[model samples]
Target: MTTLTQLEWRTMADDHRYLIRDMALGDTTISETVLHPDQSTKGHAHPWPEVYLCNAGEGTLYLDHDGGHPLVAGARYVIPGGVHHRVSTVKGVTFTCVFEGPRR
Candidate 1:
């Protein structure tokens, strides 16, 4: 039981692409990522599965083979391990990403 507001957020990626707050809970790691307008993350793959919950704004989620998907506030997406994915936003977005793996 942890309060998100109590955690410290750190900047990540080139040009402050995103702000993240990470918390480790037993075997799982939960991260909050905030992306401002016109920001994007480079496509990459992870070794463990990841789940994303959109908390605000609209965006685009790029998945390998699946192309891009609409990412609106209140949406959720589950990505399999080793699947390449990236996120881009046009109007700023905040996402809660959960995974049962080590934090990068």
Candidate 2:
């Protein structure tokens, strides 16, 4: 893998959603992803475990195994490997995410 000279990058989509950069090397990745109300990642599972910190906003975090629940500010969610999960933003959401495990 090549080294990243810049630690972070930022961009905004045409739809006005913010695209926070993810920076990492080797088997770990970290990023702050902001999603608007009703936004969501299509349900899926990754090879690694992922931790999500809800820094702001409200929503419903859904894990296929853990069931759906209200996501309040300051809450943190952890998902183990092989667990199907996805998050839906109610009134929008911002999360600091960390991922660790064997790289896919």
- lDDT per prediction? 0.82, 0.71
Q: How many clashes in candidate 1?
A: 0
lDDT (10s digit) by residue, model 1, range 1-104: 66866655544433468777777666787888888899887778978889989998899999884768888889999999999999999889888889996577
Per TM-score, the best of the predicted structures is 1
Give stretches of model 2 more than 4 Å off: 1-6, 10-20, 101-104
Task: Give the best candidate by lDDT.
Answer: 1
Q: List the residue pairs that clash in candidate 2.
A: none
lDDT of 2: 0.71
On the 0 to 100 scale, the lDDT of residue 31 in model 2 is 69
